[model samples]
Target: MKYTTMEQLLLTELVGAQVINHGGIKVCLRRSENIPSMGGATFDHVALFVLDGTVVEWIDHLNPWDIKSITSLKGSETNLYGSRGAYGTVLIETK
Candidate 1:
């Protein structure tokens, strides 16, 4: 999974974050705000997983304090099942 410069730009602008290339993907570590449903009422750091050219999920539920993981699949078919992006997908979890 390779993250393009354009994709990195989009991510930084969308989330005000920086990218770390790791495990064939761009990882973003961000600190977010309160989330009631997750038993989180304060700011906390979360991991953003991103796979370049892959599909991402759980976009709607992404918050400031959420940790996200993104990955891209090479030579793979698009699931298009529950993802939110055309290029790739993300997994959001509490830190």
Candidate 2:
């Protein structure tokens, strides 16, 4: 399917403005909406991440093997983060 990402992720269900981090840590960008503003949005405006259940400001370093699963939430599904998930939310389950 056509896609976009902090890297790029693949999902048949991914819609317009949707994103996925298919390569490496970029996978955490899943569900990040594509909104090309005048100033452009930063990664923080792309998606909020939950690493091992702890909400982190950013992923400093991540080992592929440490990742157990990756889930993305968008639109109304992101209410849990308040405005943090306005773009989307990436839930990273690590080992």
- Per-model lDDT: 0.36, 0.54
RMSD of each: 13.3, 6.6
| Candidate 1 segments exceeding 4 Å error | 1-7, 32-95
On lDDT, the candidate that comes out on top is: 2
lDDT tens digits, residue span 1-95, model 2:
33343233323322343333323232223433443322333334556777887878655456444556667787798898888787677777866
Candidate 1 lDDT over residue span 1-95, tens digit each: 33344345336544644343322324233333432223213222223334333335224333443333433321123255233233333443334
Tell me the deviation in Å of residue 38 in model 1.
Answer: 29
lDDT of 2 at 54: 80
Query: In order, how many clashes per candidate?
Result: 21, 4
Per-residue error at 45 for model 2, in Å? 3.1
Name the lDDT of candidate 1.
0.36
Compute the lDDT of residue 68 as modeled in candidate 1. Answer: 38
Work out the TM-score per prediction: 0.23, 0.56
